[model samples]
Target: MGRLIYDGEHRPIVLDDRTLAHLKVVVTTKLRRHEGFTMSWRHPDNQPRGRSTIWLHPSIPLKFIFDAPEPPELNQRWIQDLMDSANSSGGIALVDEVIDGPQ
Candidate 1:
């Protein structure tokens, strides 16, 4: 499993490489604009809990597994929201989330 860190929370998700790279770019741009982000997703099947949440902050340097399988499609709304927030903030304050596992 991989660690998904965001919004002051850390969790895991199943994701792939291309998606991770894409997410990194999106997050970096947001950080350049000082916009903080939030990510919410389901917990791993192994975990007994429910969904999870994290806040990506500029103060944190995040890492993720490059071998995990990423979802085929990205949530366009999320990317747009991040860009919009980043543009408004002048820089992104945090990365927001990280998907665990091998991408």
Candidate 2:
């Protein structure tokens, strides 16, 4: 699993490396543009039954740590979908990457 440590929080939000990789792209783009958005996701099976959400802003400190030494190839379609969501009123909803989209 990968870890996303925000604002020096004691409990880092853990996610799979692949998901974290994809999310990193979106979060980076948004923060680069000084845009902030909310990202929400359902807890994994190993965790308690619940969901978590966080607001991402450029001013906030965020770190993405991966178990894998190298970053994985990113999906452009997934990134576009995430960007679209971030532009929406509801903000980004962390969804599984859809491989059906064009390569």
Each model's lDDT comes to 0.55, 0.89
Provide the lDDT at 12 for model 2.
95
How many angstroms is residue 87 displaced in model 2 relative to the true structure, after the best TM-score fit?
A: 1.4
Could you give candidate 2's per-residue lDDT for residues 4-70 as a string of tens digits?
9999998999988988998898899889999988988888898899998888899999999999998
Q: Estimate each model's TM-score.
A: 0.49, 0.90
Highest lDDT: which candidate? 2
TM-score of 1: 0.49
**lDDT of the structure predicted as candidate 1:** 0.55
Q: What is the lDDT of residue 93 in candidate 1?
A: 27
